[model samples]
Target: MINSSPGTSQTRSITQTSISQTRSFTTVSLIEMWERFGYYGMAALLVLFMIDKIGFADDHANLTWGAFTALVFSAPSIGGWIGDKVLGARRTMIAGAIVLACGYLMLALPVDTLGFMYASLGVIVVGNGLFKSNAANLVRRIFEGDDARIDSAFTIYYMAVNIGSTFSMLATPWIKDHWGWHAAFAVCCGGMLLGLLNFALLRRSLAHVGSAPDDEPLRGSRVFAVIAGSLALAASTVFILQHKQVAVACVYAAGVAILAIFGFMLKTCDRSERAGLIAALILTLQVILFFVFYQQMSTSLTLFALRNVDPAFSIGGIALFTWSAAQFQALNPIWIMVLSPLLAFVYARQARRGRDMPVAAKYALGFVVVAIGFFVFGLSGRYAVEGRVSSWFMVAGYGLYSFGELLVSGLGLAMIARYVPARMGGFMMGAFFVATGVSQYLGSVVANFARMPAGNLDAAQSLPLYTHLFFGLGWLAAGGAVVAIALLPLLGKLSRAHQQATQAASRRESLAPAPISLNAKNV
Candidate 1:
């Protein structure tokens, strides 16, 4: 018979603690899903709306979109810093959600002026910075220590992200088609509010996860000072983007300087520190390329769909496939939902067989898939002839890209934690964000080139230009894959010390006496 003494009560308490922690994680995952719904919903329409409604040229819309998205990546570094060193994760997330809500509201204003969009994007970027990293960090806190479950947990969490995107993708574009972009923007605002409400409801359960480190609270009055400095910088950026030539130059320069700091700071570290940072840098660069390819969802691909993709379909006598170009954005998340689970199972089975795929291998595979996708796009462009190619081709490419995302893009944050030391984990996470920021800028450059008029070519003859661009993108992805494969041997070298450390941990675990049950220990 099971013991029913005071000791048993103590064991029950420990079990309860674990149960509550798991539930809190579930709450966090739900909130993250809702937050993604809001963000991706807005993103689906942001560029097209800027071009069509705001009357910017395609080039201008693409550049501004890139800049705004780059800033979104940049804010995470600052947000991670603040969450770790000042406001704590929970409070920072609270502040971020509030700011995000306000930003969306600003976008909803009927005027739709330049200032409103800039200010609104700024709020969203800064807010995302504060909230995004903290939410991931809190997930880490849910588990007591590094273990295999964390991997599975992240996979489950990532599924939630795509699942959330699925609903928003379907809804946002439909709303924009019938009610206009304002209604679409408002829907995202409502999604943001829902995330906030979810967070508030779960606060009691999540208290242990998001508190800032004991040593990291904001210095007296410094919080206000940091806020002011960030605001000034944002205002300056808005002024800068107004100048066409300077925007690209400025983003590149800023990206280099930020990364150099990370590089230099890592160099000064102890061996473990240096190794972890190296791993982080590699992970970060891979992610940068991941986003660069991913961001096309809003720019070249959207335009491609608008101009060339034939969408002749009828769904139960209702016309389908003639939806706005932005509506194609919904397809990505839907694919992710279908693909991620299958991929996760494959990965788990490999791990169980002691042949687990390395992060680098997955990243390399992703680039290869991206290259193939781009090649397909080029083929589609070549055959488009009179007008848009079949929408099914774009769908096929997006499907491949979505699978590539499951392999790398969605695996990033988890990989960072696995590789980095606990002390500087957040900083390394920031470094990952910085890499993505650079990629966003680079993607803009690529998009700008794609939109540029080819010499001696009339508007009627621009198909070759797009074909060449797609071919170029395919080459870039292929080149990246080659380089990444060449560098594969180096990951093992870099991870050697980590492997040794893990082995040491395993030895200690084997030799040490088993931990007493909580009941006996308490008694």
Candidate 2:
């Protein structure tokens, strides 16, 4: 019984097609911003929470943090599919909001048990899956055929995400320092509730955006049932995967399964699609490498600041403020917020001059810059003597990392849209995130090398450990850059071929005759 009345539909369609014409885009941005705020708020506190409250060893904490982040980003694939095929985006998104708030509520209990933590993470993962991708999908639906505006819209959308992160990373840590850990976590829960309210209140604006376009659809209560049942099954699967004996096997199995599915899809697709898929797979590897470097912010990098960095700032000999270890994470997004516009202009200028860089070359550049960040990080240890390193060190590292992030991540999404057929775009996008999720876990594994001696490492041990890890990370990223550069020419050729095929197909479709009526078909 979705309203298909002409006037209502027309109003919603106009809003969807024109970002400035309605409040819909703003509503979606607020939802995204608030949701990210809640998520990052919780994330800012997680490793510290595990270490101080749960009394987990550094190694165990790294593992748990890795698993948590991996699952959080990973769920989007299944969640995206569920929304598309079963519940539809709007309903799935609303349901996810409720669950996400619940997940944070669980963490706000002040209990220090691993069981609750794991379960809470599982719930959040599921909730994030349902919410994150579908919310972005709604943005696409809003802009529909307005391809020119969609990129700009996503740039704005990503800025909102960074804005939320910047605020939460700064606020949550301060709250935890002044109030208490549970209070800080409670703030995360409250933020999610705020997001949920925004979503519900703005439903009218989004009414035309997320409704399924397919002929056969799961409607009303059936949608809820399918989502609920699927979530339960998925949640149970997460618990089983959490088992230590099976965790690695499960990760491998999941990776293989996803690969096999995509391989089958490629086999069945037209020639151009297969070429695009191949190119996408190649590009996805570079993205995974970038995220591996990026995710260190949460793991080894956070720990580095906590154990070694001095966070005090002063202006003209007057003490300004001291930032908490977790607050150090804000630097990445803060840099993003400050630099993205400048970077956008540079990319545009390059394109205008016919000096537009290939995506692979950009990826190579991103990897190289990240390597420099890690190299800077490695050098920071010498600047740390008694237990404290200069704050400028992390600032410099994040500055470099942010520039690389600007170059790669935004274009990664554009690549999918550029190379793949519209029919397969969503699936490819999900795969991109899945690669990210995998990298989060791998990043943790890389971080394991820097794990403190049993509990917390004194400066003597920490300096060498972090130094060694950074050196290795720098080299790892440099290696990825080399590989990407080596593959650039091939990727370029495949991408051009896909673009040509897509243009040809579009032209044919444009020229094709309309379908006949039943009587005309008989005649």
Candidate 3:
């Protein structure tokens, strides 16, 4: 046995080694940061640009935005396929970054037509699909077989997302205020280009990470075929983006198909692994619901910030300065930057003390926290003097939403690694996004219900709609959290089943595996 007191130098070295993660982790995180910077910046401005600048009907814009974001999440499944089976992760990612840059450039061109906007969105969607999942997949690969470290690493990687989002959400709106919409889109274009350049610079650090697949090398004629096929697929996405009905159908179909596949895979796993998969699926459903609420930060909530929120100051007498509805979106990412590391420490401390929050409880807590945010948000509308409420209401809601985000989406990555089979890593990561994809659609559905008359936020009829719709959603989400918490025992049992199955397999291997090693050469 080896034992050392905390004061000893040996203890200090062990601590250093524990704290230091892979070099690839940081580089990939930087890639993610810049990618999110463009994505969220565009996202924060998209709806407002449609309604305010392009004159799209509110209903039309919301549906379009929802469908576009849904595809953004869903497209990753195919992207993961290309990464895992066609081009290597790194190459696919680089190609995607280029596409992303092109997409943003399209947006920056100042074509005020709906068709052009949809085309730009489709290009970004396909680009995001290719880039997003492959990057996360690389992170997962780096920490393979080490469950203990995977959670913290994924948490850190998820942090990169908010860090970038915070800056973009804050900066893009300000850019739009000063330089106009085209300039804002140009900023998004510049962000993606920065990401691509960073990835190239840091390519050497990631060589051992997302390398080309051994069996699926890009060579000669095959490369041409892949390129042509990708182009065709990209064209199809543009067509779908222009057609709302078709895009909605595809999103629903993808969601159902993914669920069916995950269910079949779960049935095939051994008893131990089966439990974790089942728990993961259940938790994923809850996560979908959480995103249904989260997605509103850009849509309905943005509307609220514009019409109902007082941008001059908060309820607590703190000064508030939001020049545009889009600028308000920055608050969520800012809160996330503050909250993620703190929550990670709480979870790490819990684990160190031989106690960990059960998967279901964590899910429950996330839902509850978000529910409370919505609850407060809903109340803000009621307490408003005349038509305006304190900006503090939205800020506080964002703070809570940020905490829940870390608990659910941040920890959800770790949950996937813990619960699912290694062979299914790429598929499962894609499947996780499928859940998010569906949530985007669902969020749109909910936001659509709160839609006021087009360009009529100041209308008397619009005020009640925002207040009551949010209040209803808050209660509904809180109730859902309560139901989830009650089912904690079941989720915990499934988690234990995974452990038991692994133990049973180990016992069988230990007892019967010795004889299997007595091959002719050994004998």
- What TM-score does structure 2 among the candidates reach? 0.89
RMSD versus native structure for model 3: 3.9
What TM-scores do the predictions have?
Answer: 0.88, 0.89, 0.90
Worst 10 residues of 3 by lDDT: 453-462
Please give, for residues 11-73, the per-residue lDDT of candidate 3 as tens digits: 788565444446778888998899999999999999989988887776777877888888888
lDDT tens digits, residues 468-496, model 2? 99999999988988898899899889877
Distance from true location, Cα of 435 in model 2, Å:
1.4
User: Where in model 2 is the C-alpha error above 4 Å?
Assistant: 1-25, 141-152, 211-221, 224-242, 315-318, 347-356, 518-523
lDDT of the structure predicted as candidate 1: 0.75
Best lDDT goes to which candidate? 3
Task: Report how far residue 46 has shifted in candidate 3, in Å.
Answer: 0.5
- Structure candidate 1, residue pairs in collision: 308-388, 308-389
Q: Model 1, range 423-445, lDDT digits (tens) per residue?
A: 55555566677667778867876
Error of 3 at 329 (Å): 0.6
Which residue ranges in model 1 land beyond 4 Å of their true spot?
Answer: 1-21, 211-223, 244-246, 314-321, 452-462, 502-523
Q: On TM-score, who's better, 1 or 3?
A: 3
lDDT by candidate, in order shown: 0.75, 0.77, 0.80
CA error at residue 235 for candidate 2, angstroms = 4.3
